[model samples]
Target chain A: MDSIEIPKRIETINSFKAQGGKVAAVLPIHYSRALFRAFDILPVEVWGPPEVEASYGGVHLQAYVCSIVHNALSFLKKGGLEIADFILVPHACDSLQGLGSILLDFVKPTQTVAPLYLPRGKRTEDKQFLADEFRALARQLSNLTGKEPGDDKLLECIEREEQADLLLADLYRNRTGLGLDNLSFYRLIRSREYLPAEQFTELAQTALEKHSARNPNGIPILLSGIVPERMEVLKAIEELGGFVVADDFACCGRRLYPKGNERDPFLRMAERIINAPPDPTRGNSIDERAEFLINLAQTYGAKGVIFYELKFCEPELFDLPNLRNSLKQAGLNSVHIEVDIKDPLSNQVITRIGAFLEILE
Target chain B: MDKIVALGIDVGSTTVKMVGVNASGDFEWNYLEGSDPRVEDQVDSFLQRFRTETGMTDSVPLVATGYGRKLVGQAEKIVTEITCHAKGVFKQLGHGGTLIDIGGQDSKVIIIGEEGQVVDFAMNDKCAAGTGRFLENTAGRLRVPLDQMGEVAIAARDEVAISSTCTVFAESEIISLIAHGVKVEPILKGLHRSLIIRVVAMVRSIGLIPPLMLSGGVVKNPAIRKMIEEESGEPVILPEQPQLMGAYGAALIAQKIAVG
Candidate 1:
């Protein structure tokens, strides 16, 4: 993700901390950025940093744990997150839930750890359940920080994040025309993980301004998975005569939250996360995920879906076969490729992506 | 005889194949040899020999395919073995169908469209169980020569089950079977069966489109074709030269630009 000098994670964290702002080391998938900001905490997410030596995390975790959880714990054990004032672990999947349990029950680090439970369905009661959970987290933050922001302050923060997300959605809407390569586009998208909403909005707008009719003529494909970890994958895709036109990756497109209409801040946040795109991690059905993927592919003119996934991720892996079958039945071709974040991008992966693109060609 | 005007070389893990096509893109000349560790040097020597023998001093468009395609410095283009194999077989067979290419390093089942384009495909990832190496490793372990593995396997009346799908683990299993006094023929049959089962599973995943053709150096083994037919219940087809499809396809792609 280049040509745009997007602020580094370390720089963002230090800047926030220097401003007397507390940093929350958030784990993957969903969390309330507005709520965290309301309590003077900056939520910078950790998606395995993926390159860490996982031995420290391996000491506490079972051998089967996904590298994201292992690397997060390993990174923490190695003092990677010592500066954070809080750690937020969302129950996005069983592995992440286990990570939260391990942190609370055993490898208790110094940061205040909180686990957020996301609602499975988009039903009214589901939204209410997630709202209540966020409310409880708000109470936890209030106790931990001894500073309670009023509804007005909370709403102000929500408005800022919503504005930033609106810009994110705009970026997605006009992604192809932006002339951003897979790596650069993803870099801009994932900058949301650490950069404050206001800052992300500025960079996103600048990217949109540099838009051109020079959208790459490469075979358009959709990427669906927990995360796109390796930079080589993007480079490999481009080199192979293809580019990601759409994504269902947990770290990027899946987190494109729509604006919530509720007046209550927590309910608004819950509405956004619960009503975001259909995802397997939230226990969404194969039919729902497949239908969404079909629509996504059609909307973006993607020839097929590449289920690029991480190894040992049960949620994504569990839904893979059925989801792939459903897509095939609908006349959408799909392929599954797994990667261990601890390892470098292998030639096999490049060849798989290469062959898939060749098929689409 | 037509004059050679285009070139394609497939630098596979176990072997290197370079095929020359005439102006109309029919295979006019070809070369095959064990893969050398120094692929660039190997390719250079191959090109030098081609120039000396063919007597066509002018350079033609060259397209490289396979794992070591990138190492071929003289190539004007590089295409993946998947596409090259599909294109090669489609032209040779006179129709589109599911084509399985089981190389020494990896295996792929590609669904070919009517126009010789790849429609859909599946590949075994980072594993040798579904590939030629699976049988090659076991052939050495069973003390059977690589070329005779098929004949020895086909003659066996009883095929003992080999439980391990991993190439390395299958070697250990073969040892255990031999220690238990299992006949080498049956063990060889079991290994072939193991490989076919894995490849067929990949074929089924892509929902095999028939005419069910085979390619790659591994398909040179007669038993692989017969067993694939048995396992898939679909007749398996073969081109004139199964091992040269990748290079042939690459040559065809180069031919369009070379003579046009």
Candidate 2:
């Protein structure tokens, strides 16, 4: 297969804008991309974008805020998010909740703010609460777009996202035989952050069809974290004889949603998200996350787990101790590497990963 | 030397180390020098010295390990310090156990399995508090020679509390202590205590494995060795030429390729 041509985020954003479609700037982790599409709005995720001078955002936020919020607020103040017609800040964690509050109550940017409250746990009530939250967001989106999309139209959009997610999951299932490098694979995976469901479906299908056959090398490992800010870490893992067989990153793998079973579109969307991989931000219990990860390791033949997280990410930091202990009990070794977004991957990070790979070896 | 067949180079942040091993995996010869900014040239010059001193025309496989290992363009393989140290110590000591390597800039706790595999490991964060630099920084303030710090510190029965874990701040804290007329010996002992406490925190995190082993440049410091033993209540084991373990391990890894 020829080198896969992935869509660039800037060009995609420009093309969508040129079509007179409004863009909703999405913040980390879970949100209703399908609902955004119901109002003909494109959802573009913001994950720090790395290397932004966070001075402006720093002025407003505490020194301890995670770089994602710091750089995001700074990026907004710097007008980097001017292309966004609305900013959708989901209450993924306390820091994100604070970001939403700050945007709505103060430092209000030109873009309209849409805050979505995420429910904790996998209880039936949690699903109902989230579904209700989605319905509320849809109403807000309706007011912003000045056109309330019917339930049927919303369901249609939800089905489109479900299809895209299925393909994404399939691409992961076929990752090893796909023979793509770590960087290329992640690039394709993250393309969903901005690409439309149809476009993402097309890209994912192209990748799956173009799967080249090759014997994959390196010790298979699972990655769990808030985000992979420093790309060099992945390269280090590869060069040091480690292969990422699967991941549980908030920006990538954790969002892999199975199909939902509900008559209402909002409930369906909520169910899909709640049933997706257990995430630290989602307030899933340590047991749930550990079981999911152990299963992931068993399914993928991964020998170890590497928790590659950005510093000051409270949600990830909270469950790490229990999660690591649980993994060790299951006979799957793990390592936790925390890093700052502004700095490049350090030798310390590389050494820890290299050593962990050696442990697996 | 039974004909040196493999070479290992550890281009560390503070020093460059090279080791040669024979067919039977016995260390044949070694070289050490301060780490220079131009690593490629330094390595090239070291290789030239090896050829002239050993007077061996046979080519040997070279494995490089260190933070600067990537700069060793001529190396057949680049391994990390953790693996290299574990291999070097396990090969020399002939058993698997917990190994603590306190280098100038980085500190590591590696649990070696019974078969010489790295079972688990943890390195110091970006902070220098748990490393040799932390001691050197504060020792410089107290006017203690790096070599004699351990001796002076170990002898002081009444040790002051060195509360600052930050290397730079420890200096400021030292200055404040000096102004308060605190005894130098007690303060020096406290500084050593502080460093050991930081390392012990890491050891506690992974849980201590018995027959605790020591390597790296700081292993030469007796106070650190004795204090670590005291902190963990486990006897410390030392390999010959602890400073050269990384390079020695690299050489041992290279032996496989040479024999193949």
Candidate 3:
């Protein structure tokens, strides 16, 4: 199969601008459809980067501060982000609030603050308060855009997005059953950004439809890693006759959205994404990562699991001790792969992964 | 007479320290700064040193402490640094002493009762804010030897306050201060004070009390000690070579086990 070439989105941004598209960029992860599509008029997120030279960490904040926020700020310092006409800042985490404040100071975007006030529902009035808040936010957006989004348009957009999501959810479901090989698994994750949500959904569905026709005679392997920036490493695993059917990485499998209740899609989507399995420990706390692998091995008839740890990523390193212990105790066939993103395309790592999978089978 | 001995080794990222205490609460021997790489190999060497240094190696029970305690061979008991440090501090200060231990890679503030048991503790393992690593980094940036930072900090006529909370940022801030004609003395003083503030925050989180016993290698720096006292509003009880306190505590635990 030939590799798919991703069209440059920069040219598309110009067309989007000419079409008077409202652009906004998302914060932290900065991976959002609304923000990306709003190319000309709005940037999804705006936040000041942390001073990298600061060694002690924030004196006021706890040491367990998320490094992702720091990375976002670092990228901003390097002018890596696209400028937006407006941005929506949400109080997602403590760092997000700090990033919002920093973004407000520097980015000079038409700032729209999204305060996620999760109500405990202790009192009936609290639930009412939340509903009122949500309505107010919608009203605020409507006022800012100067286009009162009718119920029909909103519902239509929701349905379209939901369809895309259902296809994605189906991909996850199929992968869960067939046990994706490490290489193909990572390739699929990388394939997501290259195609639009709808197109990606179609591709996934097509792939699943043809899964039975495709060769499944490979060693079943669980591909685990901290955010794998490069897709080739996963492909190398596939080339070695090992199929990665399961994973625990946050940047890939876990980040994909599954279909949610359309009656209240946005809120349900947010809830599902929030409730999605985070890494079991600090860093990538896939609490059920080991369990997921074991279950997949039993269900998909996997022979081994390959755990990938990124270099200098302490959170993953700390989790590995317990993860390795659990896998050993479970008597699950597994191998640990430590990957340094700096040496991403290393043949040495590929050879090791191949040898381990070969031995297990 | 046959002698009983128990060994306690604390393997830190930068250094390996071990102490052996006999059944009678006597210091049989002590070994510090073993070979790098696998610490299990170092333990074997330490055991050999125990016999060479003290001329007695008859069935000494071993208890391991610190991060690499589990990796050490045949540790009869594996205890956490929090427990060991608390026990060592308790034996020295005898209860109601807040322990401030700033080691190579991490910093910890432990509050203990009279029994030397940990009541509450807070640690900064993720960042080098309050740890010795911060000072090491800051000294390197300042081009001042770490051993000299203590004296330099103490000599400052006016302290140059640094606002950056991060140690990496603090070094640049220190350099900029120097470029702006700030005296080295005050800048160093400020740096030490910044570290003290970070540790003090952890101490406050764990709850502060009087008669603080400062432990860990960072205690070797008197300037840091003074700043900790000034910031904490209570003088720290100086343990002799506080870096050895954790090892000493492990030794004490070994002694208790051997005697029993």
Using TM-score, give the best candidate's number: 2
For candidate 1, list the clashing residue pairs, or say none: A1-A184
**Ranking of candidates on DockQ, top first:** 2, 1, 3
Supply the DockQ value of model 3: 0.02
In the range A1-361, model 2's lDDT, one tens digit per residue, is 4346888988999999899899999998899899999898999999997878888898779989999999999999999999999999999988889999999999988888988899888899999999999988888888888988888998899999999999999989998978787777888898999999999999889889887878678999999998877776777788889889899999989999998879799899999999888887778899999999999999999999999988888888888888899999999999988888878777778878877887777
| Stretches of model 3 off by over 4 angstroms after superposition | A1-121, A126-361, B1-4, B24-26, B141-145
User: Using alpha carbons, what is the TM-score of model 3?
Assistant: 0.48
Docking class of 1: medium
Cα lDDT computed for each candidate against the true fold? 0.89, 0.89, 0.62
Model 3, A1-361: lDDT tens digits are 2232333445534555677765544452312342232222333332223224222223323344454455455554455454444445544445656666666665433446444443332244543444455455566566567766554554555455457656665665576443455455445544554334555566666666655434555676666655554457767676767666656565555555544453553454344344444443312343466676567567666667777765444556667657765776787755556543433365445544644653454
TM-score of chain A of each: 0.98, 0.98, 0.66
Q: In order, how many clashes per candidate?
A: 1, 0, 41
Indicate the worst ten consecutive residues by lDDT in candidate 3 chain A. Answer: A34-43
Fraction of native A-B contacts kept, per candidate: 0.69, 0.69, 0.00
For candidate 3, give the lDDT of residue A347.
44
Writing each residue's lDDT as its tens digit, candidate 3 over B1-260 gives 23537777887766778876657654555678933778778888888877787778476778777767668866887666767777766766666678888988888777676666655555676568778888889888888888989998898888878899888888878888988988778888888888888889888754677778788887878898888878888867876557777777787888888777
